[model samples]
Target: MSDADAAVGAEVDVDLDFGDDGLVPAVAQDAETGEVLMLAYATREALSRSLETGRAHYYSRSRDELWEKGATSGHTQELREVRVDCDGDALLYLVDQSGGACHTGYRSCFYRRADGSVVGDQVFDPDDVY
Candidate 1:
């Protein structure tokens, strides 16, 4: 067993490389429910924090800052497992979610249809969060 693998409790870090944007894709899923909740971006710091703290953290491209999930919304994700893709360009965060993972009151951010259909009925209101 290698030192890095033991430190991360994983097989290996496929490739710890990011793009010029300094961002890598992060996939968040419900640890117990086995449902995909959200997809965000994580910088090196965010990934380190998530691994160290066992909480989901992300980098907001729009805000250009670190985002600790549920910091203000009270919907934090407790990290259960963190995996880097073979290419190391993406991550998977399995977590125990508290409150609604979706800003729309759903359990996940992937509440919309993939067919490009219009959604009129909202499960939750954004006003409640923002």
Candidate 2:
């Protein structure tokens, strides 16, 4: 294998502590701005798919299936790198996000505060897309 391939293999081979449900929480962040985009769950297969495809893939708890981000909305996230937390129970995905990251049309899922006030602008209209 090429040196780059070997390095990726070494990184992916690490034992991640997926919980009983075989899922790990993955935090997606904007690679350029360092802004957190969204939080989602991922299966081993999802992680592998993300690395292999260079796109963000996540397991949907509600749908009970795997999905590629922006598969329908066209707000795809281009995966740049993945980092495992020290406990190996969580993942950080650095990506180049296109358009809005939140399905609610916001750039991030954290657009609101504890007071239910909006702090971020809506990048798109959910009605138009979804």
Top lDDT prediction, candidate number:
2
lDDT of 1 by residue, 23-121 (tens): 999999887778888899999989888777667899999989999999988889887778888788998988888877877777777776889664433
Least accurate 10 contiguous residues by lDDT in model 2: 2-11
lDDT of 2 by residue, 38-127 (tens): 999999989988888778899999999998999999999888788999998999988889999999999999999999999976999999
Please report, as a residue range, the 10-residue window in candidate 1 with the lowest summed lDDT: 2-11
Model-by-model lDDT, in order?
A: 0.78, 0.88
Report clash pairs, candidate 2: none
lDDT score for residue 32 of model 2: 85
Best by TM-score: 2
